[model samples]
Target: MMSWSHHLIITPILLPMATAALLLLIDERNRTTKALISLVSILLLAMNAVVLFRIESGPNDFENVYLLGNWAAPFGIVLVIDGLSALMLLLASLLAVASHVFALARWHAVGAHYHSLFQLLLVGVNGAFLTGDLFNLFVFFEVMLAASYGLLLHGTGTLRVKAGMHYIAVNLVAALFFLIGVSLIYGTAGTLNMADLALRMPQMEPDRLMLMEAGAGVLGVAFLIKVGMWPLCFWLPGAYSAASAPVAGMFAILSKVGIYVILRLTMLLFGSGPSAGFGADVLLFGGIATLVFGTIGVLASQALGRLAGYSVLVSSGTLLMVLGINDGIVSSGALLYLVSSTLTIGAFFMLIELVERGQDAGANVLAVTMEAYGDGEEHDMAEGEGVTMPGTMAILGVCFAACGILLSGLPPLSGFIAKFAMLSAMMGTGSIGTTPGAAVWTLIVLVIFSGIAALIAMTRAGIRTFWGSLEGTVPRVLVVEVVPVMFLLSLTLLLTIEAGPVMRYMDATIRTLANPAAYIDAVRNAVVIEGWGPGTGAKAGGSL
Candidate 1:
């Protein structure tokens, strides 16, 4: 009997895959058919997310396991869903749907295969979130990367091709390292099942444990590269800034995948110190450095695209710092901040690109402003042609302000609430009291510095582009672009207003991640016990 749990894992993947395949079958010139297929896929994925959340709300942290071919435990392929996965899954689906809608307006402008590549990329992202095995994670990473190559270089322009090469090269290196690390881990542990590995990791010898730690460290570096943290992030701004609006929005979710994997691996395999362990320090200092570097980049950049890129870098840093703190309060705060930031930042980037596109700009302000002015005076240019309207600038201002509030930790925004949660958590440890501890001081400095830097940078960008007098005539913006920006801003505000409920839910989810025993037990119990199975397989309650 097929269960909802099974569907939960399969639906996010199948819906997108089926959509992409159906899109392929449609004539390349049939834009209407392609758009309809995209909408249906998104609706189905959203429905599946609702079902998964309902399941997760039930007792046992909403765990569901689907074992391939009736096989069980360490022997068979498994797809498991728990609290963290559920939250990420829902977020991915939401972003995917929103981005797809934003892309519809651009379909006529971009090539016909754009929709196909987009759906394929979705398949890879959804698969990454759903897969239970490490090797499968690598496979999905490649799938997403391959599709992204097409999307990033969709137009075959000189600048985009240059950026795409750098992007691909960096990722290819990361993938190689990832494969090596996974191979090493498998050779030493004899099991690739995440649950089984977690259970057995505590029993490994000290030297063997060191080897595992090294492997994990290498893997961590690879993911950090993907996340574009500090030294590893040089390729991001150029590559992302060069893509079209919809492509940039899709790319926003890409880096988060690396962070998601880090969150998963840290809590699952490394949090409890799986051998000779150094707890979260690796994440702490590295995170702080990333925050500083990203903030500096944001401050220094003259282009809107690069600024957005750097802000993403800062967001990644903040997330890592929260993870590094490792306290329940910190974890909950980090998770909330991540959810809030990802949506806002993703929306913000797309909005900027739309504004730029309307103005015939490419990340450079003076050039864009000139182009807008020139278009206004063109003899052949129609009154509304190649020009932005007043309503669009108003919409852009609102979106920019919302992004600024969320990214800069301002009040009445989820970013502020989430940062407060982290501060509260850090203070709970007496680190920031009358007697200041080193950890407390560190947290204090990090939060204050990061907040100030981000605020200044975002404020400058917002003021210059939105409020400042247009040195030249402004271009007319389209309705298709403004609607999505407003929608995403609304989501940020909603998260801020409902912080209490959101935090409570996030806390429950973080607690589950912090302690995986419940997750393991749930999956273990869900297995149907059939007397004895062949070749290393056993019933739910039996030994392998």
Candidate 2:
């Protein structure tokens, strides 16, 4: 029998896969049934993710792997569960449930098979996290990209379709980069399994190592695109801003997928290798540039959606810089920041639609136009258009303010704690001395300035949307539509409440990442068959 631990580890991927299949078989006309089924699957996936996290939380001595087709590591497909993967799985599932549930309020009906695509997207994301090798990672990456293409265009607007086309084209190029990179690495290293690659990273011939590093650099670009790094990130804001609110919320975690891969590979491939610190400078400087660019975008944003979109870039740039720092302390704080920012951005994405529902379709344009020119004639025409903010609008306003606080790294929230942890670690520890490098100081200044930019942008936008405008009205919001936003925000609040334990867990996870041997050994020694069956020699997909 497969171990119970293995079962839970595989549940995230397999459950969603199975759910998507079943959802596909269901007719689109039975929308309620499909919605309920998809929702239930996501809930179960969430529970399984939570359980896996709890399992990894205890002592984390070994990463658990389930080998498929009864083959051992480096030869067969395997699903591995560790602290980072578990945390990411939990985050993805939480975001999925929120986005999916919120979609049922109306967005689901806009597109056929929205439920199925949502589950398929989870299959890809969960698989990407769980897969033990580069081959499966590519497979899952494509799966995710394929599903996202559909979801990005879910509501079918001119904006969405146009954005989706560009999104697909860019990702296809990235996917091509991914394939070439993987092929190069496999050709040089003789294996596609990450652990096995790590085991050979330091001992490879000089020529092979060069090839591998080249491959790794190519691979990094593919993910850099996903993570919205500068130059490559130009398409991100427009695409994300054009996406429907629910889809945009779910897409928040998508950027983190790239961050996860980069972090994983950075440690496994270069932590203690001949190639140690190979791309550190690029990541550092690129991250700094990205942060600065994102801050400019944030401050210049006229629409709330674009502001939220730029915030994703800020989150990506920060984490990328953290990875470049390569310090366990900084990384731990980056993990916390990752969670807080993702939740905040997701909540903000959903809240934007709700908040904007009360305003005229061109209210953003009107506000910008008035600021740039004048509202001399337009304002008088709508003098009595404003209404008192009611309970629903008030709730949305509070959520919006919370999002701004979190995005700006304000006090009394997880965002503040996360930024404090990272900044302190960077300022206090400069590799070997008390004085940090110019790059470190640059990152610090950019982070602070970025926060201030977010604050200024959010305040200006909030004023236009709430106080400054005289044409706003109370939007009709459903309990379901509003609840998910609160749930996501509340989790950020909960992160604030449980900062100590969470940071401890992040530190432990960082420690696990610091040791690549644990992962290599776990994959190498994990049992394919728990015990030999006495029958016809058939069991478990031999499954993972």
Candidate 3:
């Protein structure tokens, strides 16, 4: 029998896969049953993720790496769990639980097979996080993209279909790029396993190293596109804005998948190897440009949906820039920001739909009127009467303010804590010549500017939605819908309350990622059955 320790590494992937398959066989009419199954499955996944996090935090062990079919490293598939993967697993599971519960309010019934697609998406994400090989990463990427395609078009609408089509087309091109890059890397390195590739990279010939670098560049482009890096991310805002609330909420984690891969590969293959500084300059500049663009987008957005979408871009850009900095202290802080920002953005997306339900009618009228006739005089957009719910406006206002505080890096929230940590790390580097470098200044300026932009945009949106008009209709938000939003926000508060432990964990995770010796050893030293091959007489899981 496999040890529970080994099982934990695979459960994040297998549990979701099994649940998704089972969900597929169930009838769509059985919504209650499906919701229960999805809820339970995700809860279990979350519990398992927490267990993994605790285990990874406690000890250094050999059982963290599991070789499928008892095949050796660089041969069979492997799933490795460490601090980063465990943390991602926990975050993803938390988001999944919140998104699924919120979907139960109404979005799940918006299309057939919603629960199945959701579970499959989780499977893909967890697999991507855990996979020890590049090829399996690609496989999981495809799985994730496939599920997202369906989720994006979940609700039948002209806008959703058009946006989904664009989303699909863009990703298909990215996927092709992914395949080409993978092919080149494999051809050059003669191995698809990440740890083995890292081991082999320094031994490569000059020409093959160039080829690998070229492949990495192509792969970087694909990941950058997914992460909404500027210029390549024209498709992101519209696609995200067009998606249903629950789908959009889940999508907050989707982009991070690309970011995760980049972080993983960069640290694993080039942290201290021959290609240590490869692509660092590109990441630095590209991230800066993306941040500028996202800030501009945030300032220009007129609708909450588009604004929320742009906020995602801003978050992506911030993380990308920090990664480019390549300092472990900054990276640890970025990880904290990553978790805080993702949860806030996901909650914001769900909240946007509810907040906009009442405003759509008036906004539509204003838009049509504006298109037909010019603004002849100064007119208050808030002149209309608003409908009031007893406590909805207050609750929504508070949540909206929380999101703003988090997104804008304001104080008394996790976002503030995260940004402060990052800023502190940058200033503490001690590498500055009496004056900070241009890059340091640029980062500091952009961080402050981005926060201000988010504050302005969120303030405008909240004012317009909650307090603008006294003549609007009360939005019919269900308790189920509101609970999930509160849950996500509460988690952010918890992150603030427990900032010390969380920051320490992030610091430890970054250290482990920076020093890949333990990771490499775990993979290299995993036990394998002798004569292991397809159809061979080697029984699985036996000692050599």
What TM-score fits each model? Answer: 0.89, 0.94, 0.93
For every model in order, what is the number of clashing pairs? 7, 1, 8
Question: How much lDDT does each candidate structure score?
Answer: 0.75, 0.88, 0.87
lDDT for each residue of candidate 1 in 203-233, tens digit (9 for 90 to 100):
9898887777777777787888888777788
Per-residue lDDT of 65 in model 3: 77
Using lDDT as the measure, name the better of candidate 1 and candidate 2: 2
**Residue 35 in candidate 1, Cα distance off native in Å:** 1.7
Cand. 1 TM to true fold: 0.89
User: Any runs in candidate 1 off by more than 4 Å, and if so which?
Assistant: 2-5, 58-63, 107-109, 273-279, 358-389, 429-436, 469-472, 526-544
Model 3 lDDT, residue 138, Cα: 92
Q: Which of the two, 1 or 3, has more TM-score?
A: 3
Candidate 2, residues 151-262, lDDT tens digits: the string is 9988867988898999999999999999999999999999999888888888999998999999999998999999999989999999999999999999999999999999
Clashes (candidate 3): 8
* CA shift of 313, model 1, Å: 0.6
Candidate 3 lDDT over residue span 1-544, tens digit each: 3465667788999998999999889999999999999999999999999998988777544277777877777888988888898889999999999899999998999789999999999989999999999899999999999999999999888999999999999999999999999999999999999989999999999999999989988988888899999889899999999999989999999889989999999898878767997888877888889889999999988788889898888988888888888988889889999999999999999998888876655674475355469657755558564355568877887899999999999999999999988887777643322445778788988998999999998887676667654346778889999888999999999999999999889988888888877688778777664565442433223110
- Winner of 2 and 3 under lDDT: 2
TM-score of 3: 0.93
**Which 10-residue span in candidate 3 carries the lowest summed lDDT?**
535-544
Q: How much is the lDDT of residue 117 in candidate 1?
A: 86
